[model samples]
Target: MADPNEPVHVTTTEARAGATPGVTRYVLGVSLVLVIAIFAFLILR
Candidate 1:
């Protein structure tokens, strides 16, 4: 794993903005879906 102190690099303008817009929103939506899936799996199991 990489150290947190090291600066990270990204290639997106939306990443710099950091708001939940455009590509950012797509990433967030996928993350939210994964979280919900895990929660449902745990509860159902």
Candidate 2:
């Protein structure tokens, strides 16, 4: 178990490098789902 009170430090470049790709993929997935839902709604309506 890790200590909850420990202070963790991350550099900007490291944070961006690690997070950007995953965040981009998540955003893209959500956007694709929304677009598909909207398209289906339009077609069915």
Candidate 3:
């Protein structure tokens, strides 16, 4: 087996081919905030 610590190679094209993980995290954070706001509004009413 190869060394696990060896650096893997990624082509430039491959690097740009996928959706960024940051965007997904941001979306999830926004949705969670919205859900919390909605719950708070309902509770306050």
Residue pairs with colliding backbones in model 2 are none
lDDT of each: 0.86, 0.88, 0.90
Per-residue alpha-carbon lDDT of model 2 for 3-45, expressed as tens digits?
9999988999876775445688888999999999999999999
Q: Rank order by TM-score, top first?
A: 2, 3, 1
TM-score of each: 0.51, 0.54, 0.53
Clash count of each predicted structure: 0, 0, 0
Q: How large is the C-alpha RMSD of every model relative to the true structure?
A: 10.9, 6.2, 4.8
Query: Residue-wise lDDT of candidate 3 within 1-45, one digit each (tens)?
Result: 999999989987697997565788889999999999999999999
lDDT of 1 by residue, 1-45 (tens): 899999988767657775544687788899999999999999999
Pitting candidate 1 against candidate 3, the one with the higher TM-score is 3
Clashing pairs in 1: none
